[model samples]
Target chain A: MNEAGTTVIEARNLDLTFQTNDGPIHALKDVNLAINKGDFVSFIGPSGCGKTTFLRCIAALETPTGGALTVNGMTPDEARRSRAYGYVFQAAGLYPWRTIAKNIKLPLEIMGYSSAEQDERVNKVLELVDLAGFGGKFPWQLSGGMQQRASIARALAFDADILLMDEPFGALDEIVRDHLNEQLLALWARTEKTIGFVTHSIPEAVYLSTKIVVMSPRPGRITDVIDSPLPKERPLDIRDTPEFIEVAHRVREGLRAGHGDDV
Target chain B: MKQIIAVLTVIAALVVVWYAACIPMNIKGVLTEQERAGAEVQPPSAKDRRDLSEIGLALNNSFAIPATWEQDRPRLPAPHQVAIELWETTVQKKITSKRSLIYHGWVTLSATMLGFAIGTGLGILLAVGIVHSRVMDLSVMPWAIVSQTIPIIALAPMIIVVLYSVGIQGIIPKAIISAYLSFFPVVVGMVKGLRSPDAMQLDLLRTYNASRSQGFWKLRLPASMPYLFTSLKIGVAASLVGAIVGELPTGAVAGLGARLLAGSYYGQTVQIWSALFAAAILAACLVGLLGLIERAVLKRMGMAQ
Candidate 1:
């Protein structure tokens, strides 16, 4: 296992170009970054900025056309084959056919967990996401926030060391997003998992992430990477603090700088 | 409550139109019969009656109007005439009797059910193959569509004649034709269903390091249930039509198709209409049964929406 502060995911001059009928599309270009163990890293940028694309590259969901990207000291493909991470997409995407408990147990069942062990893990993760008594309910029976929470529980159920979330709360409202952000921080604190989050919100990137990588569109490249100076413990009111605002301002400046020629 | 009223209103309109149509259709026959019984008819001559409008002749001879509904063999049987025949064949006659609609319906239904099972099984297998292999998708899909374009009516007789030459006869030939009509819809529907999972869902399974089979049993199969039931409804109805058509070429004496042929030969329009109604009723029941099963299964799976 990699120690805290050790590099868990490293991307060097990574580039990806999609071949469409029109021509070639540069989805990612010269993207360079390192995500350390137990770090809550947020890739913040607008749509088409390759933040989600970069996260996907680390999860081996998309193959980069050029450069090197490694996860847990091995290639992303090898890490994925070894079941290195759990991914949460923008939608909850829970199978409507399965109840919350069964949905949580899906990856465990796929990974060939023992039946008793699967039950134990499902119960534990359900509680971890504050959905203790709702395991028997179907996904549609729950609200959007609860369904997304159940999705989070599903990702956490297999106990993977890496969690890759691509705008998991993007579909949620502001109040729900804030509550989930706090819960996510608490989850990270307890699990000590390396999380790579992609989002378009500056306050979200500033609040939850220990490291914020600001990115821009048009041939997708990194604009800045800001390491936060705040303590690990955070609350909803922490957004009002000067230090939080300062980091948020820096993220905003980087975003503006990335949009320079276009704006 | 509102729906029942709407349905009843439609039925009433149909019956009224049907009775009015019978007046025009059977007017000449009624007038001829009335003239033979020493009654005066309009135009006074059979040759002159042929040249005038049937509706005009019916209005001029108002005394013969009531007899038009009671014709022994009219061009179009009145609604009540067909209804009485349906009741006699289905309810009045014993189910074991050859004249009973229930007996003929059962024979046709057996073939339809057999063919439906075979078609559904073959369709699902082909769909699975197509979804899994690009070669199967490229080759089999176009052939499946082309098979549907070839009229089953033209194909049914050849199948029956070919099978009759061999020892393979009766239900199997009819069932094969039924299966042929049915399998295409199932293949198209199941293929769509099996591939219903979005890219994100597939990517989620990929992230879990799930194998191809795991992705299928866990996601694809369950996702396909709704589509499967929908296709089954269509397939079952098609199967009934195929079975009825299959009975036509062989001059089979035991099914609804035989009943239709016999009725037509004797100019028994009432019998033909009754048999048509029976076949339609059978098809409706099969589709309704499938719908009930769909609701139950989807409700159990919590996929009703």
Candidate 2:
């Protein structure tokens, strides 16, 4: 759906290994993927699968032991130096001592955004997340879902072209997770920002992603990349639609395939 | 409420018992062997002299009248005596006056604050080193633990002597001792706190192309605030201990420790008690102040109430 010709991130034959007491744990092996500009992609698999490792490799948090990984046509490290993406963790990870507004302002301050620009972006993103008036509230005072929303707002505030989320809604209850999934779909539809989301939930991956990359464990490697057939204009009611079910089924199949199950 | 009431009741009973125990129960202030030999020594007070006339009368009078009510037995120096002493030391005399509790308190306080600052700074640095490097962890962590095992009381005199040899007498030597004792908690707290971020969070930062320093400032340091504050409270208390210990060995002319020594030498029990109370109050105030700062910092970070 991304008409943009630019490939935002490209990983080719990427391999990553961690030296453990037992032996070297191969976290990733010969992984290849490309994310186009404004694309929404999800990496989904069972625990210890290469989904997280792949995500980390793309983020340049972990260096690939072999092969090349690039973001915005540059090395991950180069992209990082250029401040190319915004990241949201599984947990909200908001500083407890900070108000929502201050927490959002932290990256902005570090990245050297002017106060006025920081204020503008903070207000805009807070409004985008439906948390305009709740800026003064601490993360603990808010519900778990709200804290996650605040963190999302913090990522959005920077207005980066890419947003990297690692199971951002994993801790929320099903209802809240459903609500957040819908909100996330809407946000993606509006911003058209490139997203590489990591999740364990098939429904969540199918609901929000344009592309879902399924991975397997024990020397983590990608098994399949399933492109969703559902329409881009997603709504809360879309989850009940036949087309949505078809995509979810496909993601489930991809996950089963990744687990080395015939599907 | 019940706990508070029980504690108060216990304290009241203890006071009553203390008064009873101090009363002349047929024996008076450890009679000398010579006096016990029927030498007929003159009693120090007329009450004692009068009571000696009749054994039953003396015993009855001593038991019947409240020991505090009797002229001889000033039982616990009456609350007013302590109040008068406190007023004269803290209010009547200026804080800087040589005889003032505030003056001695300031000496202890200055050392505590200095030591706390040094300890906290050193602890943070050491924690960072340990967290970042396995070499430092293997090399420094064991020593840090070993350092704590050495009783501060045993080390205080050696610390003073070493500093004196280097021509570094006065506040610096005392402050160093305070810092030595105060840093351990901070190092431990900060190390735990700095590493508190989960794997996913670290990945999130990496995905953003954030460098190590960026990740630290943007993530680790902020995450460590709660831990740092908790350690600071502990560190402040330890710093006070260090400062007091520092005062003990050097024969410092001023400070709560010096006041204690002087009071003990002259048998001014009340002065020693007052000085001990003053030191406790100073430590409490310092810790309370650090707590206030912690609250403010945390609130600013969107963490605390």
Best of the candidates, lDDT: 1
The recovered share of true contacts, given per candidate in order, is 0.91, 0.74
| TM agreement with the true structure for every prediction | 0.98, 0.80
DockQ of each: 0.91, 0.48
Off by over 4 Å in 1: none
| Model 2 regions lying over 4 Å from their true place | A1-6, A257-263, B1-7, B13-100, B121-138, B161-172, B194-202, B210-218
lDDT of 1 by residue, A14-132 (tens): 99999999999899999989989999999998889999999999999899999999999999999999988989999999999999999999999999999999999988999899999
Tens digit per residue, CA lDDT, model 2, A1-263: 34785788998898899988999999998988888887789998888887877776776777889999889888887877787778888888887767899889877877789999988988999988879899888888899999999999988877578898989999999999998888888788788899999999888888888888888887688888888887888877888999889878877876786777432
Model 2 chain B scores worst on lDDT over the 10 consecutive residues at: B67-76
Predicted complex 1: CAPRI docking category: high
lDDT of 1 at A83: 89
